[model samples]
Target: MNLTTTAKPIVIIGAGIAGVHAAETLRNEGYEGRIVLVDRDTQLPYDRPPLSKEFILGELSEADISLRSNESLTALRIELKLGVEIVSIDAKKKIAISSDDEILEWEKLLLTTGSSLRKLQVKGSDLEGIHYLKTLSDAKAIRQKLDGIQQVAIVGAGFIGAELASSFKKQGKEVTILERMPLPLAHILGEEMGEYFLQLHQSEGVHVITEDAVVQFDGTTQVEKALTEKGRIIPCQAVIVGIGVIPNTFLSDKELHVDRGYIVNEFGETSLPNVYAAGDCAMWPYRGDNIHIEHWDHAVNHGKCVAKNLLGGEPISYTAIPYFWSDQYDHRIQYFGHTKNWDSAVLQGNMEDKQFTYFYLNESGVIDAALLVNQPKNALAVRRLIKQQQSVDSDLLSNPEVNLKNVHVQENEDKVSY
Candidate 1:
């Protein structure tokens, strides 16, 4: 638990973006210590953003999605143990026990285990054609099985599901999306935006059913149909479940506080002094509340922050605003900030015009987040506004004539709440 020690190797669990970037960051920060990166995935750690989109559509290969090259890993002196699972961690001794019963000790530990895709628990979920596109293997399986497949049933309308649906539609496969919500992305983007997503999918020849949950998958040896609780059966040759993910927190101990993720401080330090976490597995502070952001950008930022702080310098707070983007059909949806408790949203531009931006406001009138559709420039403006925590008039935000970059943020009377 000695945070100042730099003699022992840094053992990083999970060779995803966070873990790999942390190793890179530590080297960049001039730390010449040993670095060990481990993961259960046998393949090289790769970028996951393309798994459902370009990768599934056959536009990108596994090599294209890789975050690091072999040359880079060797240059950074990162010892990668692929296909190796760390069964448990001995926090007191700073030791990680692998699935193969190999023990490794560390001066500092980083838990970037990320999360696992939530599996469908209904009957016939184990069928051959049912898929969950979380890993490279999953995407490869789906790509191979998609050969000669006619229809695909998507189980959710979240980002992953929507992206997969768009990919399938682009690949000339019949896509049917079953969303339990009234509209796609309803909980995150609200009704109107969700409806726009519905229209976008429909315009691309994808079928959608709202407020429907798949009760079971029906097929003999492979998934052929999805039976919904609403008494509807969707016929398809394959099924992809994109319900969500659960954070990997099984390795947490009494020294590490575990909630939805491993609770960490602003510097990514867990309750244990020398142990830290980042990425989807780390829940750190966000404006007074603890939030675990699962986006790729957040992972990169967190890894750098943890590396900087782990070097025993002035602790750098990991307060970078979370940003995420999804490309579906002709639209590129860019969002910044966390919109957990947004009270109101104002939309500018015409949804029919195919260009619009939505500004999310907290109860205190401060801009908390923004969603821009095919408006990349406005995304920068919104990012600045959110970074400044500016409270602008809702009318100005809603006015199409007013340029958001020029619109001044007002100090609302609700400033006391924050």
Candidate 2:
């Protein structure tokens, strides 16, 4: 698809990974038309995964996590408008109004607004020491505050909370994670895996409190203690809440189809013609369901996939498999595929050894997902099995002698029926 030089610029909102990748993909795909990337943040687009780990641990500087430098973006002919936001959009006119009231005309529009961190709304929520890690500035504030505080309390046991707990423990601070669930990550990874993580944190001298919810925070200026629902009081000088995030859909009008997120097809095309949305803010069709994934890899791939559809030609369907990883206390957790319901979870190794793989299978005995803990070598093989949707012997999957690469059962072979 050839775009004329006189064509209007392609306007992409949100200068995070999704928007940056889309702009870069447009240039790489030979689009000569102008491309403008707008973002509300003043800082250059940077990697977000490190904000809770390396950035908080002081191992990586601001420049180190930058996705692209100004010179690099300039060379690609991608104009970046930082510290600007698209307040509203007129879908019929193909124009967007910015926060400063500057109107932008676009040949095509891509919304990658991403997500915002959810805030705790209990008593004393306005305390000065309570923080949420979502952006660079948030991480910077937490890092700066860590210098004067020793007792650190994390409100959730999700990925962000776990990673922050690991970072805080590394600094020799008294870290305690308060989770409302009976076992951390039980809803996602099941109770067995959640118990494994609970042990992992306790073994590192970090206090793990489960089945308790913080009802109020008691402090005059800063958070001094957290009051729980079960009459438990946790004394802490600082708090970090990582409950979850909500997709940014404030710019979408009523005319646009909106569910949990901006509903889009496999091509990433929204309800409005010539308008598209990707990343966390868009819910695209996956398998048989419309799901929204808020991970770095999905955002990058979804942006690139949507960029191809921006050009008026054959549309490319987004079919990338979901993958995400977390680093906590010398152990790396890598997950491939996505499934909220699984019939059985087959364990590959001993959980006590801190090296294992849990294969989640559906009722059809097909591999739905796999989680690897400190087993990097089996990641590729597990991903392939899940992508192939192959069924294997559960005994072989649990056997330490059997390699994952050779566990694929062909037709006519007796396999474990779930």
Candidate 3:
């Protein structure tokens, strides 16, 4: 199903960074076809990373973070159908059915539908003051209601929860973070680093409650307090739930292989022909297995890759290294690569000085992932090494005097664990 021979539009079922970038990339690749960008959001596509950071701090506005300029989409001749929900996709007919019974036939379809915030299933979860920050409107609502709020309770201690804690604490608002885990980011960063993060939050004057669950919200009209399972009551005027997000895979039918997200090949194409998926909604091939990444850089690169492949040229495998960063208080934590399991993690520099790089090694002693705190240069070098799939000297990696760029791997020096 080459799009060049068809008259139907190349429809993108999202208007976020990924979808918008795909449309722009298509135009940049000399694709002069009908491109339609559909999104459930009415506002112009804006940057999402700032929503939990600068936006919450009142340092950035929606206009300042707009992904594309006002005339950019029009200049590219891309049609936008904002605030419209896509009901389903007919792969055989190459058409998308909208919620309003509108049919859109497509020469090629890209699903960058993204993800939705995971809702808490506890009692009184539907209370008025409970907030979930995901979209721009969600941020706006939080900002509007945050003024004069003395005691605020934050559920979950992930990225969003931690960032919100920092933001609120900066404003001198008393913030209490309730986490079900023993420590913040325990599963990802390991318990040691998680403890460091916990200490970091405490140093910032943010109260941390670990291994506690909010059983219910206790209030009449608005949330006044949270009742914990441990027989404790956390008094607060507002609550922010930031446990996690679930991929928006509702549109994926039997024809489209769906697990946690829409399954895609190396080229970002789904099982059905002329159908593609990317961003947070797409579970793509990574290394030897399929993984879904919900990061800004991954989504942008995914969109670009899908655009090139959808242009009917040589298929480009979307195997770019995944990167993610988190900004809390004054600490900048940057991570490169992907790994669920690692044999050991070698630490470089001084963790006591709050400046260090940790390398996660596979069973074969090859670096699968590396994270650096306030060390951008080391992060870049590690990213390069990981992309090259090269092994490094563990001694030099642990030695602060040794430069990471000098640690190179010969072809024979690398070995596979399995």
lDDT of 1: 0.87
lDDT score of residue 325 within candidate 1: 94
Worst 10-residue lDDT window, candidate 1: 409-418
Name the weakest run of 10 consecutive residues (lDDT summed) in model 3.
409-418
Please give the distance, in angstroms, between residue 192's alpha carbon in candidate 2 and its true position after superposition: 0.8
> What's the C-alpha lDDT at position 292 in model 3?
85
Clashing pairs in 2: none
In the range 1-418, model 3's lDDT, one tens digit per residue, is 2347457989999999899999999988888889999998899999999998899889998899889875888999999989899999999988999999999999899999999988898888888889999999999999989888899999999988998898898889999999999999979878778998999999988889999999999888899999998988999999999989999988967778998999999999998998999899999988998998899999999999998899886799888999999898988989899998888889998888888999888876678898889898787678877887755557767888878876666656463221
Cα error of candidate 1 at position 75, Å: 1.1
Per lDDT, the best of the predicted structures is 2
Give candidate 3's error at residue 170 in angstroms: 0.9
lDDT of 2: 0.91
